[model samples]
Target: MSAHPTRTDTLVIGGGVIGTSIACHLAEAGVGTVLLERGTIGSGSSAATAGVVRTYFPGSPLTGSLAVRSLAAYHSFADRTGTPLGLERVGFLVLFTEERQVEDFRREHAAQRAARVKVELVTAAEAARLNPLLDERSVLAAAWSPEAYACDPAAIVRGYAAAAQEAGAVLLTDTPVTGIDPDGRVRTPTGDILAESVVCAAGPWSTAVAALGDVHLPVSADPIELLLTDPPDTPPATLPMTLHADSGLRIRAWRDRVLVGMGRPGPDESRQAWLGRLSRLLGTVYPALDGIRVHRGWSGALEASPDGGALIGRHPSRPFFYAAGFSGQGLCQAPAAGEIVRDLLAGKQPWTDPAGLSADRFPAVAPSLR
Candidate 1:
């Protein structure tokens, strides 16, 4: 690739939410770093997200705590970063369409509570009161968590990037990174960079990046689509974000539009998935939003894992490290994941959970597949 393009103490790939956040913390820690992006920073899935920051994740105590701590970190970032992180104190609603799922929702709520997350179950009447448009007959019950939240993902990532730059970290946009070798050497479209370490925060492209080390991460490039509506935006009558209490649908009213997402989509799903389901949901859940014209439609690919967890630990085989497989939760988790990455790069003790995120927890998908 051109010998060595540039050199730094740390080389961070991708420049999206995870990368910028990691770069910020590393620079703050006095780790001379260079962040390379194939495109504009924060212009990928991070920009296309609904930005929900929830602590009600079902399992793994470390992740739950990591999310909680990340939320706290966002609060501080919003204050100084001026990104208007939109840290709405919205609670979360697990809306159920089926009777059996209500029981499951309660069980999940119980599990969440046991993990120390502030959550509970609510009846149809209570949920309807929370958002009058809800169909009491269709939605059997819900799990509510008042402390859960949302934010502006783009702003947050830009804030982290700005902070990183201010702290002496260098970021290169439109610089496609081609490969890397052990001991932190990176090859980009423009040149190569030598550093003490490489943090592969390439998001959906993580598997491709990790392959240079012969490491196979169980991450797939999955697409997500969300829609926005015209403004004169009014507060969404206290509707916390809703995950399909029954189906894969995850609905949240952000700005003036009802943002919709499905936990999983069909193999051949398209961008139309967002509009198609959202129209039906607006009619079923809240007839009031039925006629709201769609103003914008967008889609992005995320690096997802089978277990729906993140990979945030140091590499077992090389000086390469990672913060990948956020599935869809990287927005809130990035701050804490960044802090953990900084600690790992510095050879200091990790202050956050590394158990569920280590490469050891997930066997590398076969090398050929990678």
Candidate 2:
């Protein structure tokens, strides 16, 4: 440890949704916490998020369970912390264009129901009834979950930060951690911070951040683009967030306008070109938005694990823990991820089993920079 080290019970790296949420939970648990962010809070991948909160994952019990727990937390966030979650439960719709897809959803639906999740499997006509903009002719079936909601990504980050601060957690923005060791020493620009334990919740940068401590995290970064289009002729405030599973496109109401998300498999050659192509797909999904001009578009990095699920748990042999690799569902699982981190540090069993999220699931390999 450096001279005059800033000591803390727990030192959290990153200020995005996951880190802030963990800080809030740790501080609320009476832990002496310090959170460091290389830049402003929610300025990384979180700022570019569409903020869609849905509890729908196929063949992913860990992610689904976490989303369910996190959704419950979001539902009571404002009341618990006095910071509004800005949640809008307009519902979520997952569309299937073929019978096979419907069958897949049916299996997943049964699994969700077994886990006590509330969901409805609807036909194309019923789906159209929920969102009149839907092109009933193109849809075969859909899964609707009325408990799904959306919120301001930045607001959630700020709310968690506020709650953390209120509970005596120290937040340091623009303070980048230069290095870290397995011994729980964080080297930053200002000075070293000695902590009993450290957490890496740096969103897409988790792998790189963990490397500073000679710990390899199997995480990859994927660039995602989001386009906000001009308000429709008649805004539908009650419109459910719609997902075209076949085309890998999603759309949700954003105030008077609409927010669109595109999941491109590989690197994007051009954002404008990509957005243009995705816009066309949106038109196919909902002919009502044909030729609708896009108002703005932006791109951000999303982290992923080999299994396409979040990595949350303690490192192999270090006084360190991590919560990352959330792919694109970080917002929906942040609350539960925070609770898991807190429970791990406290040596208490979490209410929900996190077996699938253990870091040991993947090999200890360094993340490659593409």
Candidate 3:
């Protein structure tokens, strides 16, 4: 017997949050869509995300705008589809340690306010009061954004995928796309899929996916280390997800335990070594978590764009399109990106100009996916 035909108006080549979100939007709009995942949806870096949702990019106006617009979609997600986004409104706090950093914090607060985010500058004491675990002596000032939240990244992916499936989109988990042609022909193990358009949202493997279409995406793999502590007696619900700007460390509530992440300077160290360093850092900052037993830890890959903004638009040279290069903010921007891709496919004017995010901005320096 012949294999069943697998064709779609648009073939999305990843099942992460961004790809799934795009599938949901396109299928909901009555466009035939198919999503293929090498593994289960959200099984990659999306599963390892911190899921800190906040519209507080200080110097990045475009990124900040996209985040704000996406937040609206997340806020209404559950109401529209009856699937919870797993959002925890624990708030977000950015603690500044240096006196000079105070001005920068103020600037970010002003920009956030301009973006209509409910935010303010709080004194160190007030910051400590907000989260008792905060080290007042180590903090000079903080930007308190009450509207920020923490969420389950996997939940968001499942929600998006479920919605997409409900809208008639075909989701083939564990189905990997081996190759693609510029003519929108996708090669897979079971069969070939001829599509009118193909979207590359393969996350860390996005560069490789682009190469399949003879396109180059200026995306780099960014590995991040995160440590999760054993469940404590009382869940630290009062503690807002805190970013220690000076030390490049962030701590947040996760389940009945806490999740700690160390950013920058040592991305190549072993997990054990990173955890040791994290323990020392915690001792110096939030003494409350000093002796917390680190039950588990792992490193995950995130993609970075040259400009720290997501690459979202049509391919300049082929019948392909893309939505990658999120630079560790994919979850935060997935909702709006879905809409952006749908608008591009439908020939409608996007709410935001995607000219700045086009992949053609950089030279076509294609690299080996091997």
Candidate 4:
């Protein structure tokens, strides 16, 4: 071990969008911050994200509120960060094929309206008019949010990393954290970093990172798969990001190609089987895409919580913080998460009610490493 250890006011343990955003926020607030990443920035789950930006979570009002705030931040991301974020405000749609699903969404729509989210319940015909690529024959109703958007996840991470560096946050890539002590000493192959506070934002690997400190976070890394296909002829003027409620299929126009994402695969399912299921669902949902050639397909692990909401808050017994368990909403909720972590570290009131996102909601399943 080196005789002298590097020190910082705060140490962030991930280089994905979430960690970068937090580092940016901390540095912009004049805090001395150091961020360590196992690989290049955004190389983890953030790289493979769909980058759908919207404020339309039905069951979780906390997620909806966080997304609303995050959307505003993303709108002015480039302007504030002085880095370009390839943002496309193409709107979003949620298609429902069953009466029960419609009923649930109608309640959610009412709740969203009360929260000042600009959304409306529209018929299948109205939804089809908004997105001509969609087949309304089986879709009974839809929830439309015209203010939603899609952007480059990689760019968002890069933007935040640049802004963080500009604000004096030290970023080190290819530096994997091997172990973490309860007193904010992070062990790495290069050296040890003694920080006043530590933040574990390692996305899918967050669970293991926390375990190193004798913390048990009820977060799991689940597989999420996506496919890219050639755009159909006569694509709609505005290609809204669409989600099929019955099938859990997500589709959006990414540049000139159509990006399709499948639902979370079961534990025992194989990748090929999952892809086959997605293919069949795509054909049934959109017959026009029957012969579309798939350009590429890939899978990534998503950090998921039991309730499918984010876990953001401080540790109960230590000077540590975490922002994980975003399920698949990490990309859209990153900005707000940064602010929330910043406030928690500073002992200030967060802009949003973070009680619902506290990691303490989950009981520790293992004995402490101490």
Candidate 5:
């Protein structure tokens, strides 16, 4: 670790997709940016993400707009970053099993239409044709978005890192920030950095990191669980990501294997108990996969805000900014978030209205370093 102090116009914390994306945007805009990560880039929550990119955030028009913008960026990621993202546009299908669920989706469908998103309400038979593994008989209705995609999250992070470097942004991995001053000095094991502005994009660790600067961010870490299974017999060329609205079962195909995601496990639940619950849910949702063996299962954490949306803006009384608490939507919303943060730092108006994502929207509390 060098004792020499560094200086930059903007310092970004975290190296996941969000942080990398912000760095790339800032550097591309000719800002002197430096990014520090506590671990290898994308090794945090970004690596564990399902990487499903879709513009289907029900009831949140602001999030939906961000997703729409991000989808456009992802479509051109290879051209912009000079790196392939391994993106597969297999689309997204969400299933509803009850009348109430159908009504809820109907409202969402109307909102999506108003947003000019390419989405449609489909019958069970139509959904079955889109995803053969779906048991249409059990579904009352479904929403299909043809523009959805699944990509390699790590690839996206790497691509952004490369792009940021190409544009003159310094990215340091394994450099954990130990302390932060409201006056723009950050202390790390490697050395200290003085910046005009600091951005806390440290996904699940954002709350703790902000506390280091005596700021309180209303974010909490939530658990995420996922399972990978062998491809079923007679697999389709591509499998559209499927979600069961009632049960919270999400399944998507990733290359040769299928990925299954379930709701967060209970606080007291053991790994075995959680796996058992996931198995039963899988069997009930897709009867054909009842006996399929899970190849692997893992758990991760995501920063969740009370409103289940992102917190993106500068702290009211601090000389720093934050883009966190996506509530599991960070991967898909990274591009837009990056742009928003860049615009804020530059004193320029963002393309999209960011009032809904203000960090000051939540009440301020005493910084809890604990």
Candidate 6:
């Protein structure tokens, strides 16, 4: 007799950190699961990320609390999964050159304090102590979020994949879910999968899969690039990830290299131009690295939601659910986001209030946050 075809209770598309984290959480909750990926695990944004896990988001629902919990959950993932996860504890240093923005930072800091974020406002004098390389020419105060941190995004995904596999979850890399049927069924590149529920975690490409449900995932893709240098023997001991206010510069130190990114500049410029802009920004912000050469470079695309947050909840029309459009901040929010989805699917308590992140939050015929 022929064996019955493989079937799972749930199907998760996109095997990046988000997808794998969701799959692993569901499996741990005793949900039968199968995760499909278009490429090898961690090949997407998850791998290309510099992994800046900071807790300074302004919004209420997902910005601050989700980050704190997610940071803690990463530790749990590493401990439970037996993987060498890079859970670094470097804090964040955000500087403002404009006086008006410094006031805005104070309000943000106040909100963070209300939200119980371990962050504080510091004077330009204190900021200089942390890194003399800071652009003192543009004098202003800075905010320091001591609880903020970063991790090796690639290692986190790998840990989740390994744990999910150990928990009896089937992981299929290099296979894509081309379609989703109305009856909770998934059509893959090679075969059909009948699942009770499907979780769409396809980062930048989520819309392509969610469209089958008459759901318009308004998220586009744009590549963010970065360059690194040789490791500094005495790395900025705690060279916190610094994000410049007006300049849109994001910087961090790892191993021996300073990994920096120029926040998603408009998509009009050429890739090489983007690289040049970042190089100049880094050089300008830290003159010490002026002649310091770039040893390597990488680019990763991200999806954004209209509200600048992630969509994490059940589909309004479909009984079974999905989540997408993390909007560039998904790396740090993946754990709590996945847990909320997993809980909702399992009918658990403490629901994820996704009103702000509703798909309807977009403008009329909304544009994706690429």
TM-scores of the models, in the given order?
Answer: 0.87, 0.93, 0.90, 0.93, 0.93, 0.89
Better of 1 and 5 by lDDT: 5
lDDT agreement of model 1 with the native: 0.75
> For residues 58-172, what per-residue lDDT tens digits would candidate 5 score against the true structure?
6676788888899889989999998887777888898888888778777777667766577778999999889888778889888888878877888899999999989989999
Off by over 4 Å in 6: 1-6, 58-61, 230-235, 264-268, 349-352, 363-370
Error of 4 at 78 (Å): 1.9
What ranges in model 2 sit over 4 Å off?
1-5, 265-273, 363-370
lDDT per residue for candidate 3 within 176-272, as digits (tens), equals 8888975788998888899999999999889888888777788898777677887765666677888887777888887777888876447577767
Show where candidate 3 strays beyond 4 Å.
1-4, 108-110, 231-237, 264-270, 363-370
Error of 5 at 226 (Å): 1.4
For residue 341, model 4's alpha carbon misses the true position, in angstroms, by: 0.5
lDDT of 1 by residue, 1-370 (tens): 1123478988888889899999999898888888888889898778778778887764444566778888878878867565667678777777767767766656566555555677677888888876665777767777677777777777888899988888988989888777777656777767778887888898998888888756677789976666665542354655677776555566677655666666445668654784576667666776666666765567889778778888777765557788899887888688889988988887788875466677667545433322
Write down the RMSD of all candidates, one decimal each.
3.6, 3.2, 3.1, 2.6, 2.5, 3.5
1-370 per-residue lDDT for model 2 (tens digits): 1123479999999999999999999999999999999999889888888778888775575677888989889889888778786777788888889888888877677678766567778999999989888898889888888878878788889899999989989999888999996568899888888899999999889888988987777889887777788888877757898888787788888778888886864464566677678878888878878899886567899899888899888865566889999988899899999999999999899887766688666544422211
Model 5 Cα RMSD, 1 decimal: 2.5
Local error of candidate 6 at residue 339 (angstroms) = 1.0
Clashes of 5: 0
- The lDDT of each candidate is 0.75, 0.84, 0.81, 0.84, 0.85, 0.74
For model 1, the stretches where C-alpha displacement exceeds 4 angstroms are 1-5, 59-62, 79-84, 98-111, 229-236, 263-265, 268-278, 289-296, 364-370
Higher lDDT: candidate 5 or 6?
A: 5
What number of clashing residue pairs does each candidate have, in the order they appear?
2, 0, 0, 0, 0, 3
Per-residue error for 82 in candidate 4, Å, reads 0.7
The pairs that clash in candidate 3 are: none
Tell me the lDDT of candidate 4.
0.84
Candidate 6 per-residue C-alpha lDDT over 1-370 given as tens digits, one digit per residue, 9 for 90 to 100:
1122257898888899889989989888888889889889989877777677866764343467777778778767657888766666777887877788777766566667765577777888777676666766655888787776676777778888888878878898878777777887787667888888888889888887788655677677766767676664456666887878777677787666788777655658776676677778777778777666675567788777666777776665565466777777888788888788887787675344655555656666334321
